[model samples]
Target: MQKITPSLWFNNNAEEAISFYTTIFKNSTVTGQAYYGENSPMPAGTLLTATFQLDGQEFIAINAGPQFPFTEAVSFTVYCENQQEVDHYWDKLLEGGGKESQCGWLKDKFGLSWQIVPTIMPKLLTDKDKQKAGRAMQAMMKMVKLDIATLEKAFNGN
Candidate 1:
């Protein structure tokens, strides 16, 4: 078992959420599931918890009812090796009612926030030339989905 798994509370959609997440990420899997017992609030055999892995990180999702909601304060960051990877994640994640947010942040259909960032972003943002870094920052702010080429162009002052 992992040391500490991030648990998501859902209103009876833990199974569905796990399935959706597994499809979006590579090397992902639904590890296990638990059902509510007879004495539980939900009916017996109802899905109560689902343990899953995205890429390699373990997560747990529970069908604990809608007392809580996902907020932008917590989000997962996907670091892409290139523009194509970034686009792939950005497009797939934003499908089915997902909303795009500023600076590469997006909320998926399940309301989980994600940051589709490129691996080059840190390098550009931390460049010794403040002007270049500022330009890159400006370029990123205008985009919903991050574009590596555009960021690079801005970084080079093109």
Candidate 2:
């Protein structure tokens, strides 16, 4: 078990969100779950909490009613090795009611924020040559789904 697991609160679709995330990320599965009992505030059998793993990262989802909703203040970053990986995650994560945001950020159907970042992004954005780094940053800002080719071209002054 992870020392610190992130818990996401949902209105009442913790199960559905976990299922959707498992399908998008490989090697993911639901680990455990708990339902509200008859004496609880919610109806009996209502999902109270669910534990799941995504690519080895453990997360807890709770059906805590509608008191709280997901916000862009916090987001999960998906480090992709290349353009193919980036595209795959971007497409899969944006399915259903997901919406694209600037600079490789997006909100999934559950309103969870995700950053599909390319692995090369840091190297390109932090190059010693400020001009190259600036160009890469510019290219990235103009993109919704980050393109490694474009970033590389900008970095190379092409």
Candidate 3:
């Protein structure tokens, strides 16, 4: 069991969100779920809570109410090894009505913010050579979905 798990609150759409997420991630799975019972706030059989894993990270979701909506203040970061992996996740997560944001940030259909960042981003952004790192940062700032090749070229002063 993980020491801490992120719990997402949705407006009676936890099940749908779970399904969408599980389908997008190759290594994801629905671990368990609980439904509302008679006398509960919601209709009987309605999904109340669910637990799932995405690439080994466990998360819990609750079909609560619309009182609290997801915000960019809390976003999940997906570290991709290469451009292909970054593209795969960026495309899949933007399915339905997801909105694209600047600099590798986006909001999924459910309003959940996610950062599809390349694994090499940190290394380039923190390179010992300030000029090279600045160039890479500038290149990344202009991108919606990160491109590993562009970043590499910027870092190499190409």
| Candidate 1 Cα errors over 4 Å, as ranges | none
Q: Per-residue CA lDDT of candidate 2, range 26-138, in tens?
A: 99999999999988988899999999999999999999888989999989999999889999999999999899998999999999999999999999999999999999999
* Reference-based TM-score of each model: 0.96, 0.98, 0.98
Prediction-by-prediction clash tally: 0, 0, 0
lDDT of each candidate versus the true structure: 0.92, 0.94, 0.94
Prediction 2 TM-score vs. true = 0.98
The reply for model 3, stretches above 4 Å from the true place, is none
Candidate 3 lDDT tens digits, 28-139: 9999989999999999999999999988899999999899999989999999998899999999999999999989999999999999999999999999999999999999
Candidate 1 residue lDDT tens string, 8-37: 988777787788888989999988888999
Minimal lDDT window, size 10, model 3: 22-31
Q: How much does each candidate deviate from the true structure in C-alpha RMSD?
A: 1.0, 0.8, 0.7
